[model samples]
Target: MPIFEYQCRECKKTFETLVFGNQEVTCPMCKGKNVKKLMSAFSHSSDGKFTSSAGPGCGSCSATSCGPS
Candidate 1:
């Protein structure tokens, strides 16, 4: 039950899907077999705080900490 993110090289669309065993992955948008797995980041919360391996804030934004500190 491992969920992985992928980016379709043909359409340049990014998406996530559940993968099991040695099954092949296809782009949900264009159904293209030419896809590449992307490196994903993980996050968790404890003591009423949110933290991520991508550091503070969303990776695409400049805000410091996307959750309560």
Candidate 2:
């Protein structure tokens, strides 16, 4: 089983769920079946500390320069 974050399409609410085999997912707020999985941010733990994949803003951009884009 894996946890996934979802945004309800009907009520516009955000929620998380632990999905199992063939399990139906729905919003806990409005019980809406229409939902979309969000592009979740990733993180990792090292030496008992946590770090995010998208470090600080650091005025950095992958496809474009740090200027106004």
Candidate 3:
């Protein structure tokens, strides 16, 4: 089972759930079933350290102008 993030439309609370099949998702705070799934950001690491070509801020710095000049 994969963990997925869901935002409740009624109470605007964010929660996570392990979905196995067509299960009805409800908010843990308000118990509202009307929820929307949000795309989660994830990173995998084996040696506890990971590096990428993208500097930071989710690759938003495409101009490469981040520095202390």
CA RMSD of each candidate after superposition: 9.6, 11.5, 10.9
Alpha-carbon deviation at 42 in model 3, angstroms: 3.1
lDDT of 2 by residue, 1-69 (tens): 387778899998976678888889989988879999876523531332222344443334454344343
TM-score of 3: 0.57
lDDT of 3 by residue, 1-69 (tens): 587888999999987678888988989999889999988524432232323445653344555565334
Whole-model lDDT values for every prediction: 0.75, 0.66, 0.71
Q: What local lDDT score does residue 3 receive in model 2, on the 0 to 100 scale?
A: 73
- CA error at residue 42 for candidate 1, angstroms: 3.5
Best by lDDT: 1
Flag the better candidate by TM-score, 1 or 2.
1
Misplaced by over 4 Å in model 3 are 43-69
What are the per-residue Cα lDDT tens digits for candidate 1 across 19-57? Answer: 999889999999999999987523421332223465766
